[model samples]
Target: MSPVEPFSDDSPLGASGAEGVRALRVAVTRPLSGERLENLLRDAGHAPVHFPLTRIEAPSDPRPLARGARALLRGEMDVLLLTSVRAVRSLAQALETVAEGPWRRPEGLQVWVIGDATGAAAARMGLVPDRIPEHFVAEQLLEEASSWARLDGLRILFPRAAAGRSLLPETLARAGATVTLVEAYRSVDDGEEADRLVRAMGRGELDLVTLTAGSQARVLARAMRGTRPALRCAVPMVAIGPATRMAMVAAGLPEPTVAAPHTVEGVVAAVKTVAGGLQ
Candidate 1:
């Protein structure tokens, strides 16, 4: 397969001119779960190489997700917050297990997604998100949730990664919402991929690295230190948002050029902006 392909008309970046945009050898630390983002990067004239960092899978202990599913079916959950598309799919499996049949979302329960991508995932499962944050970030989700006066006495179910931060649940509790945080999935680093990334860095093949999740940032740091001598390549990092950027910084990596609007298109724009400025 070609390392880079021409952007298609269906791609969001199709209409965007690719001329004069310096295409960097960008390293994406996650597998291509969706090709939209990668297409956008290519549309903006970048060669994106996927060096998978973490693999997403169902959690070992499924009881927490099962209970959350039961709560929803019992009409006890007022709102369901999904941070990632994987969470939505995992929750769907848990729901099927709990219901012992095809799961139908209970009426009167609101669904909130982190962004358009998650919303699209929910849509595939016959769900329509009640709310999508203006900014695709957890902080914005909390802000949006807090704006709804009815949340003061509501029950919210959040099924996310096992290592997810407690900020969402804690913030909701402070706002008087009863929140149930369930571990629906586990995101663990792929050691083989990590080694490959370190090797690539050692060969000085990557020009820019994009980290979308904090966990990915942590994994990348571990990979950089995988060799006896650390692979201290000076490639610029591009974080999808502030949280990921913070994680990268905390791991002693260089501060990243954060993507604004927090979307695939946004990342393309951010990279183009950086590239344009360098000329």
Candidate 2:
């Protein structure tokens, strides 16, 4: 699915146009070779290196997630918060297992997604989001969600990975919302792929690395443990959002060029801008 939104303007550095990207060897962090994220890079005229840092796995126990799906279908939850496209898919899987017939939007369930990609995924499952923020960041979501609806005393069902940033749920809890988190999936670091990334970096074959999450930065750092710190600091990188930028820094990697609009298209623009500077 081409969840990537098209940017109307020229690349800020003037790289993407009729001629395509500037032949930059950009390293896309996830979504594999055939996904739209990689295709977006290829269609832009950039050579995108596949770097799968994390793989989504079914949780050790799937019962909780299944129960969450039932709750969603029954309209027992007042609000639904979806942050990633994977979460949407996992929830949908659960729904398919318990659903007796065609998927229908549960009445009275106000769906809220973090980004256009997540929202699109939700819609594909017949779940329409009631609110979406202009910015995709979780912090921004918390800040902007105030204008949407009464968050206090609401039962928010959030089906997410086993481990993730706790800011959203924690803040919602503080806001007096009883948030029930169901581990719909597990985001595990791929050790083999991380090793390959390290070798590529040592060989100086990578022009730049693109990171989509703080978790990716942590995984990259772990994989590059024995390498000289200079190697990591030297390689150009771009973070998909501010939270990721901070995670990169905390993990001892260089601060990356934070992508604006926090989308694949924005990452491409950042790569073009970085490539222009490199030239």
| Superposition TM-score, candidate 1 onto the true structure | 0.86
Model 1 bad stretches (over 4 Å): 1-17, 226-233
Say which candidate scores most in TM-score.
2
Candidate 2: segments with Cα more than 4 A from true spot: 1-21
Task: Write down the TM-score of every candidate.
Answer: 0.86, 0.91
After superposing all C-alphas onto the true structure, candidate 2 shows an RMSD in angstroms of 5.4
Which pairs of residues collide in model 1?
none
> TM-score of predicted model 2?
0.91
* Model 1, position 244: C-alpha lDDT score: 88
- Model 2: worst 10 consecutive residues (lDDT sum): 1-10
lDDT agreement with native, every candidate = 0.78, 0.82
Write one digit per residue (lDDT tens) for candidate 1, span 1-279. Answer: 123233344532223337766656667776554477777776677767877688877798989899999999999999999988889899888888899987777889899889898999988987789899889998988877766547788899999999998888888898888889999889987877767776777777766678888888888787676454444536667888888888988986777889987877777778787666545
Give the top-scoring candidate (lDDT): 2
